[model samples]
Target: MSKQPPLDKFERDVLDESVPIQQLLRLVIVLGGRAFSEPLRLWARNELQGYPGPGIPLPTYRMITAPLQMDSHSRFSQGRNETISALALPDVAHDLVSEQLPVTFSVGKLQNLISHQDPHTPLKLGLPGSAELARLMTSERSGQGVVVERIYWSVHASALHDILEQVRNRLLEFVAELRATMEPGESEPTVGQVHQAAQTINITVGDHSPVHVIAPHRHSATVSFPTRPHHRWWPRR
Candidate 1:
């Protein structure tokens, strides 16, 4: 029988619920660098650093649906924050107020947010173009002096937690598949082999479209992971 290899150890580490997401992510980064796959490295980097800008499309998993809220006050009242419907806003603001808002915070940042926030409180995200939308709303009112102060998307902490879970699950699926590709007794995989494994699972690894819509993996395994403990691992050169 073939002896356990480095890939096997890495696989075990991935399956260990105790391993922090950041550490696993760093390992992925190392693997990507070793494989010389820019796409692989880019995926890991984006997760660690958050998506850079609009130019880089976010993975479908990062998109979330949440309640749109508006904080406003009239000349009479102090301020009121309440859930606002998209229809209430001008047509110009409709697109920004939709259910799906891309979350671009890094893994560490997300964990920090969850730790600091109360479980019941929803995380508020200020939407772009909110000021302009507020102006439009005030103009529509045209008399009562109801000025909108903020327009934001309110997401539950659990929702953010779910994003981390999805990422972890996807990583588990990836490493398991990659390990399976190694020949018995092979301690390491070739660059071609690594690239092939990524392609088989439809992970973004190279020059393809930046956005990836995750699908059910053909090699999906039924496993439950423990709640991850907070730990951090910074990548090394």
Candidate 2:
């Protein structure tokens, strides 16, 4: 008979970047499967470095961690419309009463498992100033003046080719078909018009919860409590 899967370890940064969404549910399945089939008692023991607790059960524990920033933009919605705040990733699902999981969800493994998923694109991650239009923020300007900001982001250059190739095959065709239906006198979109467009192939996922996860896909629980803050969201001015 095939044996049950073992539990596995997961890292935050890698998983969040590469696989945080409901669509990429494979990540959670693979890791959780590994956790079930692998031996992870020592690793769980080590996670409790600060406070010594009896080793956390590999299958019974869960950890959900996510940090997000909210922004308002006019161009974000369908129209050049109202400014709205959307969660980069939603929060963990909760029961209104005990503030716990529904009785049906596995409670023992819930906290021990660490999963993070988002409905939108992953927040831009990289060297601070390079990705952000404005690097400096003064608390002195907190309540008052306006600031127009832009943060540029990108997927890995090497990987871009494959995804772009898919886009070329799919979305490009759709656009061409649509253009043909336009009025005979209509002009084609200019270079700038086409260049400014967003992706047609988007990976949809679960709620906005901060957890790096979709419903079934849980991100890795592996962590590196590095001595330095790799990237602090809002560093002290």
Please provide TM-scores, in order, for all candidate models, with all chains considered together: 0.77, 0.16
Off by more than 4 A, model 1: 1-5, 75-79, 204-237
| CA lDDT, candidate 2, residue 229 | 20
lDDT of 1 at 147: 79
lDDT of each: 0.70, 0.26
Q: Write the per-residue lDDT of candidate 1 for residues 94-211, one digit (tens) a residue.
A: 6545867778889889998999999998888877666666777778777877878877889899999997887788787777666687667656666656665665435442234543
Q: What tens digits encode model 2's per-residue C-alpha lDDT throughout 1-237?
A: 863222112222223444322222233233223333121212222222211222322211222122222232233332221222222111210111111111111211221222231323332322233223232321222354423243223222222223223323323332443244434544332222222211221212123222121121221222211111223334333
Which candidate should be chosen as best, given TM-score against the real structure? 1
Q: Which runs of model 2 end up more than 4 angstroms from their true locations?
A: 1-125, 129-156, 179-232
Tell how far residue 167 is off in model 2, in angstroms: 3.9
Overall local distance difference test of candidate 1: 0.70
